[model samples]
Target: MTATASSPAIIRGATLQPRPWANGLGISHNIAQHGDGACGFGWMIATAELSGDAAFSHYPGIDRVFTIIEGQGATLTLEGSGPLRCRPFVPAGFPGDQATHCTMDGIPGRAFNLMLDRAGWRGSVTAQSLAAGHRMSLRATAIHCLAGQLAIGEDVLEAGDTMLPADNVTVAAQGAAAMALVVEVAARVG
Candidate 1:
């Protein structure tokens, strides 16, 4: 299904807290999730802080992408695949059904995670910094503010806020240090 254009949803950093993960070794703050059904959702975004090494929960028929937000990052060991290095700001994608294991590299860190139910949708996430006078096309379905301030016309977004921009809307950054994570979602193909 084609996505309908809508105003972005904004989440404030100060009004949130970390909830326990399924594994109980970490905590996460849900940023947003879109989809409706009795049993499942199409996509979800969250911020998590890992306090120790642990096994990740497995979700069949889903895809997960993660990016480090703070600290020294971690390593992911997929059940059947080689280990993956998760560094700061670099997004990594993997199957959610895999028996994933986590190992803290140095210091505990926070990460941004995007999960898509593969039976209905697929998506990607990337980090970017926009400065004043820099024009950017809001091609992604959602944008999450990571740091600093950004203005889309009269709408302003600060850290921890998420928004859905109109397709092809070109806007310039209002300040320096405006960084964000862009999430693009699409229907799954056969």
Candidate 2:
């Protein structure tokens, strides 16, 4: 759908193309991004499927938020910090320039990621749970359904579906308990 100030662009999860990760140990599906070209993105949202233990790619002057969405979680070792346990559905934020490594708990899993250029933008990720018919208005950059189903106007979003609302949008759970990740981003003022 064409997005306007009062409309939202709905992206089906099944339509995303999988791309190889920079570290070569994983693949990722791009959901949305604010800029183009290599090293030019002000912010980005994607989901990753890791294959094995590996070091994360370094992005100087950027921040990253990672959340395990499926399977068991992993342990992240970041430079200058103690080991951090990345639990399912819980977001972990860190400096993208930090020396970091990931070791899977057992089987490799999928994770949702948000990366923002520190000098240009700021962002946040929040998990929301809604009961059937519960409605709420959200002023967010994007909303990603994690489980169950959500309805935004006439559009119904399934698990993995993402919606980029041009303005504040009201959404409700369809039939059962639903969970989603809400992302909000804004340009940083000097």
Identify the leading candidate in terms of TM-score.
2
Runs of candidate 2 with Cα error greater than 4 angstroms are: 36-38
Clashes of each: 1, 0
What RMSD value applies to candidate 2? 1.9
Candidate 1 residues lying further than 4 Å off, grouped into runs, are: 1-7, 36-39
lDDT of 2 by residue, 1-190 (tens): 2268766888899999999877666789999888532357889999998777888888778899999998799999999999989998899998988999998898988999999988888889989999988999999999999999999888899999999998888989999989999998888898
lDDT of 1 by residue, 52-151 (tens): 7888876777789989888788899998889999988899999988999988888887888888988788889988878765868778777788888767
CA RMSD per model (angstroms): 2.7, 1.9
Candidates in order have lDDT scores of 0.78, 0.89
Give per-residue lDDT, candidate 2, residue 12.
92
TM-score of each: 0.87, 0.93
Query: Residue 58's C-alpha lDDT in candidate 2?
Result: 80
- Backbone steric clashes in candidate 2, count: 0
Candidate 2 — what's its lDDT?
A: 0.89
